[model samples]
Target: MRPFEFHRPTSLDEALALLARPDARALAGGTTLVDLMKLGVEAPGLVVDIGRLPLAGITLESGSLRIGALARNSAVARDSVVLSQFPALSEALLSGASGQIRNAASMGGNLMQRTRCAYFRSHDWPCNKRVPGSGCPAREGANAHHAVLGTSDHCIAVSPSDVAVALLALDASVAIAGPRGVRHVAIADFYRLPGDTPVIETVVQPGELIVHLDVPATALATRSGYLKLRGRASYEFASASVAAAVKLEGGVVAEVAVAIGGLGTVPWRDRGAERLLIGEALGDAAVDRFCDALLAPARPTPDNRYKLDLARGAVHHMLARSRPC
Candidate 1:
C-alpha cells in the first residue's frame, strides 16, 4: 500500500472531523479498503480508523433491527434476532467470503465495498469506474462476470455484495452522519446506477459515514430467503444470486419483495414484476412470468448471457424456499 498517515480516533466526532477532509478515508474492518489500497486503486492521504468509534451494536428496536455500522458480519449472521427475524440476511452474510473475513468485515464496509471488476482492480487496465472517460474495456472485452442489468456504455461491472441484495429485498435503510448531521437513506436509493457516472457508485457523500442500517420487521422480511449460485462451492463471488420474500395470505401472495445481485451494477429490483405476483400463488407459471418480467430489461453480453438463466433459476429457488412450510 502507498504510504499514508493513519489516525485512530477515540470518538465519532473526531472521526467525522478527520473524515471531512477531502483526501481522508474511513477504515473499519480494513477488509475491502485495504485490498483496494494495496491494489493502488484507492489512494487516500488520510486514513481515519473508525474501529474505536461506538458504532458496533445490534439490537431490535421499535419493530426494526438496527445494525451498527461497525458490527462484524459474523456477529450479525449469528445474532439470534437476525437468524429468526431476517434469515435471508443471515444467509446472505454467511455466503460471503470466508469465516475469517466474516469475523473481520463490518456492516458498513461491506455496503461501501467496491465492485470486484478485474479491470478496475488492476492498474494495468483502463476502467471507467477507476478513471472516468478513460474507457471501459469490459464493455467489449472479457466480461463474462460483468453485469447484465443496470449497465451503461461506460461500465458493466456487477455489484458484489450479497447482504446488500438481501437488505434491499428486506426494505432496509441506512443512517449516514456528516456535517449536516444524520440522515436516513432507503436501500433502494443508497446505490446509484452506472448511468453516465460510473465513477460515483453510491449516494454517501465524501464526508459522510454510515452509522447503522435498519431493517423493518415486517412479515415479508421475516419470510425471506437467499440463494446464491457461483462457479465454486466456497469463497467465490456469485454468478447470480436472488433474495426473495413472500407473505402469503390464505394461500395467496399478499406481500412480496425480490432483489437480485451479481447480475446488476447495483442490487436489482423490479417492482412491476413484484406486482405481478402480489395477488397470485407462487406457482411455477406465476413464478415464470415474474422471472420473465424481472429479466426483461437485462442486456447481457454474449459472454454473460448465461447469467440470465442462472438468475432465473436463483429466483425460482429463493422464492420456493421462502414460501411458508
Candidate 2:
C-alpha cells in the first residue's frame, strides 16, 4: 500500500473536516478500503479514521430498526432485535464473507465497497468504472459474472452487497452526514445506475459519510427471508440471490417486496413483481407473471444468461420461505 497520512478523529465534525480534504477517504472497517489500496486501484492522500466516531449501535426504535453505520456486520447479524425483527437482514449479513471478515466489516463499509469484478480490480484491463472512458472489456470478454439490469455500454459490474438486497426489500433509508448537515435518502435512490459515468457509484458527495440505516417496521418485515445461491456451500459470493418480504391476509398475498442481487448492477428491486402479487395467491399463474415482470428488464449477455433461471428460482424459493406454515 502507498504511504498515506491517517487521522483518527474522535468527533464527527472533526472527521468531516478531515474528509473535506482533496482525495481523502474514510476508513470504517478497513476491509474494502485497504484491499483497494494494495491493488493500486485506489490511492487516497489522506484517510479519515471514523472507526471511533460514535456510530456503532443497533436499535429497534419507534416502529423502525435504526442501525448505526459503524456497526459490525457480525454484531448486527447476531443482535437479538435484528434477528427477531429483521431476520432477512440478519441472514443476509451472516451469509456474506467468512466469520472473521464479518467481525471486522462495518455496515456502512459494506455498501461503500467497490465491485468484485476482476477487470476493475486488475490494473492491466481497461474499465470505465475504474478509469472513465477506458472502455468496458467485461461487456464482451470474461463477463460470466457481469450485470444484466441497469447496465450500460460503459459498465456491467455488480455491487456485491447481500445486505443491500435485504435493505432494498425492506425499503430502508440511508442517513448521510455532510457539510450542509444530515439528509435521509431512500435506499432506492442511494445507489446510482451506471448510465454513462460509471465512476460515480452513489449519490454521496466526496466528503459525505453514511451515518445510519433506518428501516421501518411493517407486517412484511416480520415475515421475510433471504436466500443466496453461490458456487460453494460457504464463504462465496452469490451467483444469484433473493431477499423477499411478504404479508398474507386470508391466505392471499397483501403486500410483497423483493430485491435480487448478483445479477444486477445494483441491488435489483421490481415493483412490477410486487404489484402482480398483491391481492393474489402465489400460485402457478401468479408466479409465472411475477417471474416474467421481474426479469423483463434483464439484458443478460451470452455467458451469464443462466442467471435468469437462477434468479427466478431464488425469488420463488425465498417467497415460499416467507409463507407461514
Candidate 3:
C-alpha cells in the first residue's frame, strides 16, 4: 500500500476534522479499504481512523434495534437481542465473510464497501466506476455476476452486502455524522443506482461518517430469514440471494418486505412484490405472483439466465420458511 498519513481521533468532532481533509478516507475495520489501497484501486492521501470513536455498541430501544456503525459483524450477529428480534439480519451477517474477517469487519465499513466486480478489481481493464468515462468492460465480457437491475450502460456491478439486503427488508435507516451535522437517511435512499456516475456509489457527502443503523420495530423480521445461493457452499459470493420479512395474521399475510441481492446495482427492494402479498395467503399463488412481478424486468446477460431461477427459488424458499407455522 502507498504510504499515507493516519490520524487516530478520540472524538467525533476530531474525526470529522481529520476526514474533512482533501482525499481523506475513513478507516473502520480496514477489511475493504486496505485491500483496495494495496490493489492501487484506492489511493487516499490521509486515513482518518474512526475505530477509536465510541460507536461500537448495539442496543434495543423502544422495541427497535440501534446498531452502532463500529459494531463488529460477529458482535451484531451474535447479539441476543438481534438474533431473537431480527433473525434475517443476523443470518445475513453470519453468512457473509469468514469468522475471522467478521470479527474485524465493522458495520459502517460493511455498508461502504465497494463492488466485487472483476472489472473494477483489474487495473488494466477500463471501468467507468473506477475511472469515469473510461468505459465498462463487463458489458460484453464475463458478466455472469454483474447486476440484472438498475444497471446502466456505464456500470453493471452489484453491491455485495448481505447485511444491506436484510436492512432494506427491515426498513432500516442510517445515521450519518459529518461536518454539516448529523442526519438520518433511509436505507433505501442511502445507496444510489448506477445512472451516470457509477463511481459515486452512495448518497453520503464527503467527510460523512456512518454512526449507526436504526431499524424500526417489525414483527415480520422476528421470523424472517436470508437465503444465499452461490457457486460454492462454504465461502463464496452469492449468484442470487433473497432477504425477506413477512408477518402473517389469521390466514393471510399482513405485512411483507422483500429485497434481492447479488443481482442488482443496489440492494433491490420489491415494493410491487410486497403489495402482491399484503392480503394474500402465503402460498404458491402468492409466491408466484411476487416472483413474477419482481423478476420481470431483470435483464440478465447470456451467462446468467440461471440467476432468474435461483432468485425465484430463494424468494419462494425464504417465504415458505417465513410463513407462520
Candidate 4:
C-alpha cells in the first residue's frame, strides 16, 4: 500500500471536509478499500477514517426503514425490523461475503465497492474502468464473469453489490452529505451505466459521503426475497442474482419490483418489463413473457452467453417464490 496521511474524523463535517480533497478516500469498515489498496488498485493520498462518525444507526420512522451508512452488514441483516419487513434486504446482505466480512462491511461501503472484474483489479491488464481510454480486454478476453445487460464497448464489468439489488427492488433512496448540503438520490439513479467513462461508476461526487439509506415500508417489501446463484455457495460473488417483491390482488399481480445484479453495470431493473405482469396471474405464460421482455435488451458476449439463461431462470424462480399463494 502507498504511504498516506490518515485522519479519524470525530464529526460528519470534519469527515466531509477531509473527503473534499480529490485525492482523499473514506474508510468506513475498510473491507473493500483495504483490499483495493493492497492490490494497488487504489492509492489515495489521504485516508479519512469515517468509522468514528455518528452514522451507525438503524431505525424505523414514518413507514420507512432508515439505515445509517456505517451500519454493519451483519447488524442490518440480523435486525428484527429488517428481517421481518424487508426480508429480501436481509437475505441479500447475508448472501454476500462471510460472517466475518458481513460484520465489518458497512452499508455505504457495500454500495461503494468496486467491481470484481479481473481486468479492472489488475494493473497488468488494460481496462477502461481502471484507466479510461486504455482499452477493455475483458470485452474479448476471459469475460465469463463480466456483465451482459448493461455492456458498452468501453466496459462490461458487472456491478457486484447484492444489497444494492435488493435496495433497488425495494425502491430505496440514498442520502448523501457534501460541501454544499445533503441530498437524497433514488436507488435507481444512484448507479451509472459503464459508458465511455467507465471509471465514473456512480453519481457520488468526490467530496460526498453517503449518510444513510431509506427503504419505504410496503406490502411488496414484506413479500420480497433474494436468490443468488454462483459457482460456490459462500464467499463468492453472484454469477446471476435476483431480488424480487410481488403483491397479489384477486389472484393477479397488483404490484411488483425486480432487480438483477452480477449481470449489469448497475443493479438492473426494468419497470417497463414489470408492467407486462400487472393485472395478470403470475402463471408460466406471464412469467415467460416478463422474463422475455426483461432480458430482451441483454447483449451477452460469447463466453458469458450462458448468463442469459441463468438470469432468465433466476427471474422466473424469484418471482414465483415471492408471489403470494
lDDT of 2 by residue, 1-325 (tens): 8889989999998888888887999998899999999999999999888999889988887999999999999999999988888889999999999999999999999998999999999999999988999999999999888898899989999889999999999999999998999999999999999999999999988778999999998877878889999899788888999999888888889889999999999999989768989998877678778989988989899999999999988887877764667
How accurate locally is residue 66 in candidate 4, as Cα lDDT from 0 to 100?
99
Clashes of each: 0, 0, 0, 0
**RMSD to the hidden true structure, all candidates:** 1.1, 1.0, 1.2, 0.9
Model 1 residue runs over 4 Å out of place are: 322-325
lDDT of 4 at 299: 94
Model 3: weakest 10-residue lDDT segment is: 216-225
lDDT of 3: 0.89
Tell me the lDDT of candidate 1. 0.93
lDDT of 4 by residue, 52-165 (tens): 888999999999999999999999999999999999999999999999999999999999999999998999999887778999999889999999988899999999999999
TM-score for all models, in order of appearance: 0.98, 0.98, 0.97, 0.98
lDDT of each: 0.93, 0.91, 0.89, 0.93
After aligning candidate 2 to the native by TM-score, how far in Å is the CA of 278 from where it should be? 0.8
User: In terms of TM-score, which candidate is stronger, 2 or 3?
Assistant: 2
Model 4 TM-score relative to the real fold: 0.98
Query: Model 3 — TM-score against the truth?
Result: 0.97
Clashing pairs in 4: none
Candidate 2 residue 39 C-alpha distance from true site, Å: 0.2
